[model samples]
Target: MLDFPNWQNWIEKPSSIIKKLRQKLDQMVGVEIKLAEARSGPPTGMALNLEIRGEDFNQMSEAVEEIKQKIKNIPGLVDLTDDFDRSRPELKVIIDRDKASRLGLRARDIANTVRTAFNGKKVSVFRDGTEEYDIWVQLDQSFRSNQSDLSSLFIYTPSGEPVRLSEIARVDSGPSYGSIRHVDTVRTITISADAFRMPGPVLVMKTKQVLNKLDLPQGVTYQFTGEDENRKESQIFIGQALIIAILLILVVMVAQFNSIALPLIVISSVLMSVMGVIIGLIVHDRPFGIIMTGVGTVALAGIVVNNAIVMLDYVIKLRKKGYQRNEAMILAAAVRFRPVVLTAVTTVLGLVPIAIGMDIDFSRESIILFGAASASFWKSMALAIMYGLGVTTLLTLFLLPALYSLVEGGKERLRGLFSSKEIVY
Candidate 1:
């Protein structure tokens, strides 16, 4: 319930320190503490927001407790808690309608008397030189501490007789009323937690697995919100963007090459580049489907095609200049090898440091490159770009020449079969 100012020495393991403090604090009476750190992701400090809705508060409280337990079992999910507090003691006054009616007392009179007694009635405002304070009148704290004292309160009846509250009302002690949350007109309870040492997608997958096993009561359902919702939405848009980019690239290539086959040959190399992307992510222990990784894959699409386009253009020029198909292909591959290798190597080398987490520092004030947290943010992108470009370059030099030869040879064979004059019967 308290936030400590940054007055203590820095510790490397804050969670461990908090655990130690919890152990000591548990033994003390009337004091309890639970430490929670802010959730990590985007600008919203929420990794998981599970909203449970039901008509009954008791069922909802039980469901919240169950979910909190399951969340604790999940690895790297920390600081789990719900907003409801159902254990606090409260005193409820149940008015007897028949007894109140016989005494000529209305329910409103009893309610108003109880409210005025507990909440205090403000009578007058005392003005000071610069400040005004309200004077309130209420029973002494000692006389209002227990349910027996509340039952002993007296209120005036309509016949001008004073009757004890116990004559027409009863006081019962039980669980206090907690806050009720509403979403779209239905009551809801949210259980939230922070993910530690894991990404948002992975945590969401794990949470889904846990939730799938539960058999929720009728009229009770759950939904995900906060960062998880945003992540899902962003993934859909990213997929659409990638598809549009591919279509745009294909259209441009079709115009430049004037042939569907050549454009396909160029676009197919993007798949080859994706092989290297998968390998890089696996080898570097990074998760797939990250925003930066998708960005790198899109960038690789444009980059990998450049080399193939250059080599193909030269082959076309040579063929038009009266060179044989086989001769032009051999020459194109040989002459373009240096340019292709040089371009790929320069680009890969530039990004290799970033892939390996050697951060690029543009600021002259700091020479530190590696071991910073921010450096790893771009690690997935760099690895995808570096490996994708390298692998696709090699595939372009070798596989592209073979594909072109096969397509052209098949066309030549079909032309000879259709145009031949010789016939035997």
Candidate 2:
């Protein structure tokens, strides 16, 4: 954290720096890796989280000894652990579809019924003299855990004839692995063999590199999609908003100053502000989220133009006082330097609360008018502000002045020649 930040109370400094540093470290690696394994073979593993095409669980197992050896050798590895090898869970269950049909049911229906029975879905409750008890209707636990007993469950058809559930469906058991899901798609799980001293990104990258060379089983597949998806979506949104924002900013400034040429000068500072944004993202290694992109871009519109406005305001005064164009620009630049710097700095400092994810009461109507948003939204906003202001301030106060002096001087000279014929009357 910079000591001379706009807000200077030295509260919550450590967390902010830590957050920034972690993001930076993550960017140095080629890619993040993820892998998943499940009980394999026929019946299409996909029924639960059907295996992805091209990912070979069997092939991955073959490399386990090599993986184990390398992991042990790596000095950077802080911790290596496994969820399998005695620690592994039993995912095996057999559904007798034929037996289920005999009971006028499907295997899914039985599984759902069994899960519901244990979970105890509430039916209703009647309060009796303020001593209320919950009323639940579900299958008894005895019926769920026992496989042989399950085959003995009785089912009655519409004809009122009693029949054994085993008559229609078969019952069996096997081991299955829990899945890691993405957007409702159960992809694969990355078993983290190491942590501690190992950099999080390096482990993720190396695992993927080795995994890539190996061939996967015919149908099962695996791939990596961690922050990449998040980053893509953010870039798209930020990119769209960025384009629209630039256009809108031009519209607003052209509308405000009512001069096409002047508006061009005004808009140049926004581009300069982006230079700061890139520096910040590089410095902090932020992923350029849509929220950050939007906030930073919008901030560019406001913060960047501050210096331009100062210059413009001075130019207007000189023009109104009937000064020559070239001399007026140079004077305006000199005159407007102080307030422009102050304004940009003040705005950045003012938004520090939002950048740090600090909380303020927004429960009551009074606080709502000026209070923090919910945690997630507030955090995104704060990051937007923190990054946006820092970037915009640098471009606006320093680089913008140099750029403005050049662009404005040329425009001013052209305007003078064009208006030279104006009457002195």
Candidate 3:
């Protein structure tokens, strides 16, 4: 762990290498090597936070250990730690108020006496030249090592009579931490780990599955925080933004086409493009909420409608020139075929590099520049738009024409039904 390189030149991922090292460390009982991810931005880790409202520390500790074992069995979760240290033993001095009062000794006197003996209160600063050091006065270490020794220490009452500490107070030894932590005004113990090879959302999904089967006791509750919380919130916001973007696109389409029916046909192409986007993601096994993919979806919305408008506008012009509905649609598609295919090809070609990642290897060429973690950040966006536009181009040519005919045919049937003369029986 000492003198580690800032950048690695190995072919295997750093995380995988760290995992191997961690497994070696795990073989020896009570020896742990926490491979904290050396990265920028918010740290990449998952936390299963539990809030125990009850004051029973032993019960809470048991629950925490149980949860630790549960998460430990989960796949793709590594470096599991509950962060509860039990080795540190503490001695608590409980003063007997009635005994202390009868002995004419104040509780403060006993506390100050114990603190001064154990902690050695600084009485002065010893200075030599420009160097200075604190001068603390306290009894030898032997006097504070055991309860019997501590109890033998003397504290004076107001009447100047010395009283043994055992007469007024008792010392109890147990396991405890130096400090307690509170989050949002509630005591919380967070069990956290590094998520290796699995995306944040996937890790959260698997962890929740393990949590669901366990029947938690009353007053004991858990929450998902860290990357998982941020991922969920971002997904919600992105979904809302996509909806608003679609609605805005629809309004613009309505204004352009001047016919609500025609715009509906154009919007159908957007849905058609989703199939290609999904196929691309499935083929590559990329998660959807990586920021880039959501952005691509929104960008796809605008790109998709442009092609539909091109085809639909020509169809409308043909209809206005007195051509039959079906014939006009067919001719419009035939005429726009080259332009649509060309545009889609150019766009897809533009994104191919980012989708597949840059050909340059940062390992040997410039290890420090790229560090690790591969260059696939924008891959999702590129693949989404590339595949979506390809499918959209074809759908715009064929399916759009058929859908237009069907919608127009439906309108005609509706008019005939409403305007026909009623037959009298």
Candidate 4:
């Protein structure tokens, strides 16, 4: 309901605002609030959603309450609540079958008479002009509102005798569930909360640690849902995709170089790039975005290897021209330095605007800085590439050449050792 100005105009972050609101609201008696950021993506529900499932509602509700009590005080967990609501007030009627049968009245007759008295009966239809309306008849509000009115009411028997309804049935009022939920044909109660000032996964891990200490009843178990579930699934998918990408890149490099060692040397750049990705996220204090950052890392695997491949390929060409191994590597580094630096520099420059959410308006001749919501989504990916490529570029120029030299030296030593051995036969 409360729509604020654009994100650029906000003086404080949304988290700060929610924290202030929570501080003030927590003092109010019987008041609870759930605050969430407006995001455009798949529905992930709350940051922490734990579901306690069982066939017995009573046991499941007790377990859910116990879990909530244990986790309610956890730091950074807010808006703690559950889906097991049983606060609705309802009236139940119990019928005495023997009494009703002896009076020549069936259970259906008593049910119909009580239902008609309270909910009204459609006795006839009224036609006005071209439309028809149903006419219902029932007791007035004053007469039917009190429980004592049920005892005064009468039910007609099959022999046309009037029998007091209270003699055959009794009514009791109590609290009942507002609604019930089921998952996979099993009853489930979900306890959900938002994570504040802490990562969602960390909060979930803490909650799990606390819940694991409890000995739940038989046939009752809990599982995390919502964002936790989605996060796990996404991590698995991205991990598999990253592996497939590395394998595919390795295959391509192998075919191009026609040598396993050279391709593996090129692939080492990917591992070096991963180090940069971690450094970037840590320095920026941003969580690792599973989808964006992961995809960016996979894409970086292909990009960083190009610089290594370029430098290594040129060294091979130089050596093929009769230059010594050390001389060829030195010359290749000096000759290819400009092109390699320029390639990485241009890519980093291109991603700078996106990473910082900056845009240019030619018509207004103005620069928009950190004003695009869409830009935030891709910021992780852009930074992943920029930082990764930056680090890999340096390593490609320095460390990769050393590794190539070491590998080549080892290969030559093995070849020379084999040739030096005399045949025993």
- Pick the lDDT winner: 4
How accurate locally is residue 178 in candidate 4, as Cα lDDT from 0 to 100? 88
lDDT of 1 by residue, 220-338 (tens): 88998888887778778777887888899889989988889888888888899999999888887888755778888888888988898998999999999999998999999999999
Residue-level lDDT tens digits of model 4 in 1-425? 55664556788877688788888888888766777766544456788998889999999988888888889999989989988888998777788899999988888888899899999999999999999999998989998987788777889999999888788888888999988899998899999898887778889989989987998999999888898888889999989988898788888878887889988898899999999999888887878878788889988988898899899999999989999989999999999999999999999999998888786555456746565655767888998999999999998989988999999999999999999999997
Instruction: Using lDDT, rank the candidates from best to worst.
Output: 4, 1, 3, 2
> Pairs clashing in candidate 1?
none
**TM-score: model 4 vs. ground truth:** 0.88
Question: What does candidate 3's lDDT look like per residue over 81-122, in tens digits?
Answer: 765666688888899999999978777888998899988999
RMSD to the hidden true structure, all candidates: 5.2, 12.3, 4.2, 3.1
In candidate 3 the C-alpha lDDT for residue 359 amounts to 51
TM-score of 3: 0.83
Computed on alpha carbons, the lDDT of every model, listed in order, comes to 0.81, 0.54, 0.78, 0.87
TM-score winner, 2 or 3: 3
TM-score attained by model 2: 0.49
Provide the TM-score for each candidate, comma-separated.
Answer: 0.77, 0.49, 0.83, 0.88
Candidate 3 Cα outliers beyond 4 Å, as residue runs? 1-16, 36-43, 47-55, 120-149, 359-373, 422-425
Instruction: Mark the 10 consecutive residues where model 4 has the least summed lDDT.
Output: 360-369
Which is the winner by lDDT between candidate 1 and candidate 2? 1
Clashes (backbone N, CA, C under 3 Å), per candidate, total: 0, 26, 0, 0
Misplaced by over 4 Å in model 1 are: 1-41, 44-49, 63-78, 99-109, 120-143, 154-163, 191-200, 210-214, 359-366, 410-425
